[model samples]
Target: MSPNNDKETPILPWDHFSNWVHAICVVTFDLELGQAMEMIYPADRELTERERTNICYLAFPDSNSGLMGNVQFHFRIRQCPQSMNAHTRPAIHTYNSNCPTSIQIEDGYLYGYVYFRQVKDRTLRRGYFQKSVVLLSQLPLVSLFTAVLELVAPEYFETGEASLEAACHHLDQWPPPTPATTLNLPLLGTLIQVRIPSRQDKPGASSLTPPSPTHTMSGPPSVLIPTPHETEAFRVLAPVLPHLNLLWELVITAEPLVVMALSPTTAANTVQTLVSLIAPLRFSGDYRPFFTIHDSEFREYTTRTSAPPNVILGVTNPFFAKTLQHWPHIIRIGDNNTGSPSTQKHKLKKASALKTVEQKPGVYTKYRPHLQADKGLVKRLLKGVQTGRPVEVQSALLRRHLLELTQSFMIPLERYVASLMPLQKNISPYKAIPSLRPFNPDEFLGTLEQHGPHLTSGIRGDWEGLYRRFFRSINFSAWFNARYQEVSDKLAELHLQAVCDADLGGWVCSRSEVEVVDMVLRLRSKLPRAASLPPSHPARDKLTQHLHTLFMALPEDLRAVLHAS
Candidate 1:
């Protein structure tokens, strides 16, 4: 929308730095430069010094690696305006969908999908190879983008830039990344079918769609999330499944939590999955799926005197066990290989001290969950697996229960908020505008006098205390603020339309001297357009001549109102 931007420039899906993706980067460890970004794909994206430095560092953030294989993880980086081409301005994915849900990006952030690898090689002087294939994008579909990289990065590892060119060529043939629609995109001679979820869609309300379906269904995109709970993210949660209710409480309440796992992939995926738990409700806390000791906020996050910030960190280094000990909650995880290949099993227990040696996984927390765990659900899952039920269905079962639990907790609040909308007759341009009713915790509780929030998951208890606690939480604040802004905008639009529709002469005749002056002041810029109209016209005469006469006729005492405003 800037005057300097080239509006006529056509935006293509594989433009190297298009809206779908910003760059396909290759970051490598140099002999002297430490972590370095060796290539910016398409070779046309000339990044600023700040952007280059940030991508090189943030894309491959870990400072210590104990393994010599590829470990895929996700991270977010600060967006640099100077590094962006004008065609990359925020806009719809395409003109065809007419879908209003575009990329939901904050002011200065970009999602990074990284496939970091370390391998043994004799060709290098260090006798080892370290590099990462990075996909930088503005979209928030972490699972979708990571899956795309999985199919593309393997070939790039072997053929280098030629693979990227081939990938980009194929990417150009694919459809735009539009939400609320199912896209059948072709990549490396394979068709990837995924349905992007809308912000309004609730989890568990629709069937879970796998990445590769047995047959393509024809129709509008199903109402669902991009990825199901039947992913590695859920498998990572297996270690702490028994403590899930507590995990939900901690996450929804915005408490600082850490995901500890032996594999960086597990740690990062778990963190991202936890962040996505409050689907339809945005997470407003800082999170680092892949945290490093040398990160910019290391000192601030680990200082002994400070209370732990409301954040989520996924760490592989054993050093965090001692460093983040003072943190409120910790969910330690282990490899998912405790039993047969058909089942996912892991060991975890409550511990006074974290396992510093990085062996088995365990939960270390003193705070109790508000609602008791739904033990029956766990039993049913185990029972189903015994009867040859698809174990993959277990994640969906747990996922649906959690979604319903969250929705139940929010239903009363949502109902109460709906009542805050002013009666249509109460809104008028001639009168002082009214805003949505103020949110009062005690008053809000009065509406629940007959009954408290009911959980569809069947977990029950006195959750009044939890409701009170939620009003003070960042999640509540964020959700309420969003509602408040939405209502405020509605009121503003109504007022503007009403004012525009009102008769100018009749409106002026009913106005006070001060109101007349205020209206004239606001209309000064528009007066020229009215003057250009035919003199016989109603709006032209009233808005130009009659309004000017009324404003000029105002007393000196009333004219002072203009100076004050």
Candidate 2:
């Protein structure tokens, strides 16, 4: 079916017209100023006159009937005087008669207005005025017309250069407006509106006024825009410099000269390869290489031995080698022996077995010192081997083994000491000496009896001798005197009630003169004397005995006051 041929072209909706304007503005701004559409519009709102003018100028800087012409036309339309008889009915004029429709004079000038009469209806029409009136009635078309005028004569709006190329070149210098920059344009709009002159005067005076070219919109306060130099600086410094310094440090430092392997097969092959490479350099004594099959033995060796300040090589199971890598001095040999799946499984089982053996409580106890002594000898041997002088590495190894065998005859005292350390705190001076009572020998004996099974015969005998010496060396008299003096000072500072509350089990006795004197005073102060009872009564004697103990702890000089009471 054919479409309706008689229908007029549908007028574009207002929203659609606004959208088209916005899209054009976006492309124009992006090309000229390197900014996106959102950076300018940000939200759906009416564009301010200045914003519209700027957009127009940016879009069609060279057009003659662009933004400036539209603005001028609108200004002229608004400034035109109101017609005197505009509210009255239209006057009819016949074509046969030659007559003027209206006449007026202004500013000493006379003017006549004529209307063309249509013969069919004898209706009069002012063609130019009516056309303008019709144009004004269609608001959407008016907006479009202004937009077209803005494109056609943009130079008429712009105050500066008419050359589009020059304007484009100047726009190229501006950075793309970020979201932060767009947010502040409203404030700039408000300031520009305030500065604009009123509409009553000639529009040309304001038309020539241009916005400041160098004025910059301060971006949103919270938004930070990094400069190109800062961005480049972070890029160069963030990832690259630390790695460069690390590489430099590694290259400059001397380490990992000697390699030790734990597996016999791997160690022998590694050492042989190293010897083949190092023996040809005729600079050193025989390099005493160290290797061990046991992981526990290797750990013990490393723990007791300190290597010289030179690079060293170490080879071990994959897991142990990972730990050695953390040490800056050791250079590890990688395992290159490829085996079948079954063989690899066997290797894993063997490594697990070695780890289990190393973790066993008895293994550490039995082998720790032997490993310690061996490691010390190996260190000395390695130091000597580093010199140019010839030395027997095998002989030193033999001596280390022989020394270990000899030392086995003597029992290890370290286990005995470790067992005794916890017990030592219980019997320490601060804990044992603070009591007012005399020291008990039973506690020490009980501790010895409990820990004696863990010690060797030699250590047990030595411990017994030390225990006896500790007891004999303690001066009980001095301890008692010190306690007595401390109590006396405390009593001298305290009141009679405090003295009555004190514990005086060890130092207090009825026969002591100081005790009797101090107690009598305190008892007399706290308890009133009965009129009928003598001081020697049973009740008085009991109170006097208690007071004596309290009084004995007072200072000797202060005891004189009790004696007087």
Per TM-score, the best of the predicted structures is 1
How would you encode candidate 1's per-residue C-alpha lDDT over 184-285 as one tens digit per residue?
A: 767776666776555545544543355434343543232233452224434555556666777788788888888777766777778877876665456777
The model with the greatest lDDT is 1
Candidate 2 displacement at residue 543 in angstroms: 22
lDDT of each: 0.67, 0.28
TM-score of each: 0.81, 0.14
Candidate 2 similarity to native, TM-score = 0.14
**Total backbone clashes of candidate 2, pairs 3 or more residues apart or in separate chains:** 22
Q: Total clashing residue pairs per candidate?
A: 0, 22
| Local accuracy of candidate 2 as per-residue lDDT tens digits, 484-544 | 5555433332333333344444535434665455445445654553212465545445555
User: What does the lDDT come to for candidate 1?
Assistant: 0.67
